[model samples]
Target: MSIQDIVFVTGNANKLKEVKMILSSESSKFNLINEPLDLEEIQDVDLKSIAMAKCKQASEILGPNRPVFVEDTALVFDEFNGLPGAYIKWFVKSMGLAKIVQMLDSFDNKDAKAITTIVYADGKGEFHVFQGITEGTIVSSRGPTTFGWDSIFQPKESTNGQTYAEMAKEDKNLISQRGRAFAQLKTFLAAESM
Candidate 1:
């Protein structure tokens, strides 16, 4: 199948890298164009809404004729009842990853949820959202402390009990929230293109 060009609007380098890695494949239908834009995100409890808003902004800036997608990620703590859902970027920015993990030190339940929402605009005022969630627990920083909160969140299904940072890139992507969301996007794009 011929690859189709699609704009991926994101300014975060780390995020962009992961998206590229996760979506790259021989059978991949999309040729993701990295178009970094300073799109303003809306403060909302719904993850899909925020992603849709960002996609809309990107579609507007890139032109309504161009197909585009935008992603929003969230780290939600069960103890805090999702205190930093969409505001996780700020939480990590202000408190740092270590301190954020320490916040759950007092609580017995260290459960948390990692979420990724990918919003797509068909360049005709139509919007589609694909979301993925990984259920996990918060632990002390346990691996290479490079990416945001990667060292602290451990997926419950992981047999080795390794954090995202501890796992190989391919292994992590196999179960990552972003990877799952992108999988949905890939499937949708494949069917839509056909």
Candidate 2:
């Protein structure tokens, strides 16, 4: 199969790094060309719509026939009925981690979900979206605080009770929402080649 170059539109260094780590391997079919575009993210109730819109915008800016993908991650509290679903980034920025945990203290249920939505635009005006959800709970910050929300979410799949920030990058990626979403993307790309 011929190698394909795909543009990944994102300004976030942490996201880019995590994506690279998730997608990197000798047999990978894509050469991810990073173009950090400052595209306006439309506020919407649907997280997939936000990624789709961003992917289309990136395709328009990059011109026709260039495959491009954009990703959006959300933290949804089950009790809040997905409050701050697409607005998670802003919430984290304004309230900080400590306050976010405090906000959930009033509720007995701390159940939350981590979601990653990835949209790919084929540059022919066709867009495809892939999503991955990790069932988790919001906990007090318990690990490295550098990465966004990693320290606060404990995936139910974790037997050791380690947060994403506490686990090794490889271990985290194996079960992370982004990792699962990218796995679908990789599968799609592989099938596209055949």
Question: Judged by TM-score, which candidate is best?
Answer: 2
**Model 2: per-residue Cα lDDT at residue 78:** 92
Give candidate 1's error at residue 152 in angstroms.
0.9
Candidate 2 whole-model C-alpha lDDT, 0 to 1: 0.89
Candidate 2 clashing pairs?
none
**What is the per-residue lDDT of model 1 for residues 53-168, given as tens digits with 9 covering 90 to 100?**
88888988999988899999999999888778989889888988888888888889999999999999987778999999999999888889778888989999777999998999
Residue 93 shift from truth in candidate 2, angstroms: 1.1
Question: Which residue ranges in model 1 land beyond 4 Å of their true spot?
Answer: 26-28
**What digit string (tens of lDDT, one per residue) describes model 2 on residues 95-124?**
999899888999999999999999998767
